[model samples]
Target: MSERINDIMNEEPKRGRSAFQPLIYAILVVLGVYIGSNFSGNSTFTHRPAASENPNKLVNIINKIDEMYVDSVEKKALIEKAINAMLEDLDPHSYYISSEELASVQEPLQGNFEGIGVEFMIQKDTLVVVSPIQGGPSETAGIRAGDRIVEVDGEHIAGIGLTNSKVMEVLKGEKGTKVDLKIQRRGTDDILDFNITRDRIPIYSVVASTMVEPGVGYIKLTRFAKNSYEEFMMGMAKLDEAGAESIIFDLRGNGGGYLHVAIPMVEEFLEDDKLIVYTEGVNSPRSEYRSQRRGRYADKDVVILINSGSASASEIMAGALQDHDRSITVGRRSFGKGLVQDEIPLPDESALRLTVARYYTPTGRSIQRPYGEEIDYDNDYNDRYDSGELYSEEKIELNDSLKFTTPKGRIVYGGGGITPDVFVPIDTIGASWYFSDLSYAGTIRRYGFDYSDSHRDELSSYSDVESFLKGFKVTNVMMEGLFKAGEEDGYERDERAIAESGEVMKIRLKAHMAKNLFGDEAYYRALLEDDNVYDAALEVARNYKDYAIVDGELTLLSATEVEEAMTTN
Candidate 1:
């Protein structure tokens, strides 16, 4: 009976052990799988890697070199170089700004920076005040154009090998800071002393605005800075008051600034809810900027001028207007830069302007040209000149795949710059090596400055731009003086070339003189009086029908055709 009981108990225990054996086997299999996935090179299991463990390869390499190097190395410089290299690999616009360069980088976008508020040039190793910024601390303190800053804060600065950067360092300071400047005026015998309270000085975006001709207004927008909209509005109002029926907006040589500033300015022309521009990228979602406010000049005829130097915010504004058929684009193709960069501040006060998204026109045209590792993207404008694209409309090669139709069925090309409706090929009719030498040698500028300085009293007597334009003329004596100056500067005088470019040189000299006397507004007014592009724009404003796009094609009336029409009319 005892043997039977022991046998039954042993069989029950063996049955329980058998049941647990399968569970133990299952646990071992899971442990093996986890171990293999975590350690094995050929593992297929998805185990999350730790954030800290997955260190940057570049950082790791840098650290290794820092710890085990032959000699001491500047870690900061190495890191900066690495950052720049990384950015360069990404895109052309993605760039790193060091701590030292951060302030100047933000100055234009900010519209204002605390400084003495005087435009200076290092002439003869002396800081010469080109002009005190309008309504600025220097201007308020009676600082005049052509005044030489001899001393700053009781320290003699003249003839001390002063550079522009050094001068800026000495003059620019925190707001409400006082700076005592000893000025050497051209006519004054005594060194004039003035105490200027350094304050927030504005950098104007609307460089110039005036009624170009009867019933036409011209506004030269150099950049889309912070106060651009305000400046633009004021300019437009001035034009409106002057009875301007049409507007010619110049964006030539404007290498763009803030996008927020541009969008608002674009909205000034576009109707409410109209798509201005859209941006998208792999990381960035499709975001659209539309006209939010009622446009100020919705019904006004506008002609936008652009060239290869026009980029970024300039392209955005131009593309929006073109896509919507709100304005007529005139000039050569624009600088293709449609990438949107976001300014990201690093911990070290350095900055990374990373290309976050690519922008498109309302017609879904990407204005950015194709870029590759081998391409010299910086010399693209030069390439255009070399390829004869700047001189002829036919040379502007457009891909059929890049074709996009505007709102009015007008076809526009993308994958490059914005093609103007009226393609004004670069006018190189009188451009000669001799004239170029004179211009590049600063002969004209020096002549203008000297002339202005000598006749400051007489030039300052002119109250308005119109008066200056009518009164000022580059005399034969002035031309002779300029040619002599050019000859002195190692530039051989080409009489034939000079004769060919004489009229242009005269106009430019007069413009420079005007710039010295009145301002940039007066300068542009004088310059554009004979500008072919400006004349073309005027013709467009007068008879827009002749240059209008019809059946997805533009009947761009040449200057001769427009002139003939004017004569007939």
Candidate 2:
């Protein structure tokens, strides 16, 4: 739901990248632009034809190239490359989108897209259905998990060097359009066929919601999409139903999406008319977005999880709440993204996403990291890593010139990413070179999918996540097989290394298997067994006041201050 700015961005490399990497790379690409879902509507002026065919500098140059080049040139490709160069020079965030790339770039953030609605993977030259998206056309049409898609529309797609793009080209179509698929099911002698009509399959932003503990609800929001506010509300309702007294809002690695989506989403946590965030730029006037109503969970303790991958709307959500001292933000500093973008449609369907404004937190904090004019914008992450910022909150550089104070008199700094109230350094407790080597060879994913696929009959016995957690265990035999897989991948077994990393490996193996068998929630539940940031959030949520910044220090508020904050909120 976040990080993909253009449809075909790093297309091949994207196949193996975690869903979290896009936002970081994307924010780095665009700087800090968050183009709203209603992109075309945000155009400040209509794209008009010039008096002459070749008017602008670039266009005139393109015309000259077309007129006198030694060989024929692709005018469209030329124009796109020129546009890319232009945007790359402007800032990190401003960029152009080709018409073909526009829809796919916006699909995940728009909340839905037309597709066959089966999550798939290209394994060993065959397209296998990982799971049918719930209530999707493929699911409704009876496509089952582990079904091998042999042919599409009578054309053999399997064993034909299939790529994600190739699969998308064939499977995704206009709603109500039927596509024929020949499938090879397990234990079935005959090939089965399913004619599935494509439909609007939802791309969920709230990836997981669960009662991590009694009276504690944890919602992992991956991005702020068009439906994210509604999705978050649904999550909150579920947690409330489960008797959750506190909330752990996990926005870790969330790259961010629609700005409007973020505003309303954060409005769910603030008092009426409280300044949530504001925007200002030289060309764009100052615009303030205030909370419209008293939020539903104003009095409930909230803990926000953030990290270097959290940017734009993720920063917005974290910054606003942190400014109000409404939540205890934990983990590393946020991905600094303070710019706002407005999408302008060009003469063609392609559009220009131009940065128009800079967003500021209520405390007047600019969460934009410095860039341009000798600044190594791309190397900022590396600099942070080298400077020990990830390992120590004290290492985060803050500017006193940009210092601001929250209404509660808590001193906060600006001009960098949001610094968490409680910091959880990168966990190195179980890290070792051996574990790194084992992980480098795809042992976890390979073992997980292969095991799940082979033991489907046994895994299907667990009716729910709770039962699976209780019933499933990574036995010694499974560990041996996993180690053997690592060895096959060229990682030699070091007894000391295995001793150090074996438990962590089991947790990952179990999580991946749970994800493949059950769903995303199960995967997160399995990994929560060893998550440091999550553990911090849980502890802080239960005793948030112990870490609350009152008078710029972690101290319990007096009875009068507590009553005032309660009344004000």
Candidate 3:
């Protein structure tokens, strides 16, 4: 039986070993197929590139760095560097505003901010209050003129590298928030501390508006803000109600603001369907602005004033008036800032003020001057001066490439600012080094403030600005004091120069005093008596028929007839 069993086992090829061998082989084949299929599925799904992965072109470089680089590198830092490098190739006006500085940059253009409302200057490492804005928190807090802010919230802020922006950051807060300020007075020894509650401070666009002469109105605009058009209309309406037959719109130091504000302001002076200004750019769509309604002062004799600091929207208004032969432009040439900037917000709550388009006048003249890899702003006004364009009748060199004809067929030049129809040169007659020193040293302002404070009651007795001007005098004693003050500051007083500038000094001192005692209107009314620009404008308006000659032929009729024609035509 044993022999027979051994034979059967041998024939079966050993039950334990041979039976498991085939099973092991089948299991190995099934395991191999499962592993292969799993790997293939992973390659199609789990091995795919991530959503935030870099591009295919950078994959090889990344692999090389990962394999051979000496140090670990962060991808975020490299991405930021690339973005900054890209923005550097754009224009100077195109700028990035960080999230921290976004609100401060937008506040001024928006026309209101929460602050104490005092314009200040840092002189001699001391915080000097220049002027308290009218109807503001500072004024309401009884913050007087010439007060120095020595501390803010018990922290010393006078001379410790405090910047203007830093000071504003400390002072400005939400409306109704109280801020403690320690002030140092010139005449007082005790430090005065006041808890001032911040309010919505209005930055005015119309600086001063008054009836200059019997029938002429004067309005000075400082900036084109959101309320600029409304302010301008109010001034014109007031002037018209005050029996003003002619208007002088002063845009001397106005650095422009919103384009929308400027367009409507232009419409206030132009007739319906008149072209105001246009804009075009390489990547931007062409846009044309026209007056949609009749103007309030369409029939009134108008003169527009411009200077070197008059830029952007100011240039647009002056250029439009000049192109349409609507008003006489006086004073120096304007600042040529024709580019329009659009504020675009970023993902991080920051913003980008990007230059997107270039503005052009109604005559198709571009007001933008050339600027490239290197900007040469030094030749801006000096070139105009050297060419005798400020005071001479000699015509400016009109580049045929830039020439564009106005509606009246008058030739106008582009590639720069609007050249005034009547040029009024800067009055440098009384501008000696001594005068400059006195002006810069704050001697004139200090003396004026002191004088006004001392003689407030006496000065206030006068009925009006004209009466005050006639009665008040900047005496020889005052002049001697001013000269001595100027001399102590290392300025040698030239006797002949002082005598030549005596009238100018007297007028300036009186005007400053008037401003301190009464208001800006009183000051400007006094200063307008000797203004050469105003004199020229008055002359032009007085003889409109002769001055408005196109192609040397009289175009304007009598003033009354012109008004009638304006209404009829």
Identify the superior model by lDDT, candidate 2 or candidate 3.
Answer: 2
> What shift in Å separates residue 443 of candidate 3 from its native position after superposition?
3.0
lDDT by residue for model 3 (380-401), tens: 6787778776666454555678
Instruction: Tell me the lDDT of model 3 at 426.
Output: 74
Candidate 3 CA-lDDT value: 0.71
Residues 381-455, candidate 2: write the lDDT tens digits. Answer: 899999998888788898889888887777777887888878889998778887787666667777787788889
Error of 1 at 453 (Å): 1.0
Better of 2 and 3 by TM-score: 2
- Number of residue pairs clashing in candidate 3, backbone atoms closer than 3 angstroms, sequence gap of 3 or more or interchain: 0
After TM-score superposition, the amount by which residue 16's alpha carbon in candidate 2 deviates from its true location, in angstroms, is: 22
| Candidate 2 clash pair list | 30-92, 30-93, 31-92, 31-93
User: What is the TM-score of candidate 1?
Assistant: 0.86
Off by over 4 Å in 3: 1-92, 97-105, 119-131, 141-170, 181-194, 347-350, 373-375, 393-395, 487-497, 552-569
- CA lDDT scores, all candidates in order: 0.79, 0.79, 0.71
lDDT of 1 by residue, 1-569 (tens): 00000000000011113333433333332332333343355332234545654334433444566687677757566545545554566777777788988898778767899998887777667888778999898988899889989988889988888877788889999999898889898867998989989899998889888987788999999887778889999999999999988999999988887777788889988889999988898998998989997798987888999998888889999999999988888989998888887776655677667787899999999899878778887778789999999989999999999899887788999988899888887888778888888787777877787788778887777887788899777899989988888887788888899879999999989988888888888888888866777777788788765675667986767789878877989
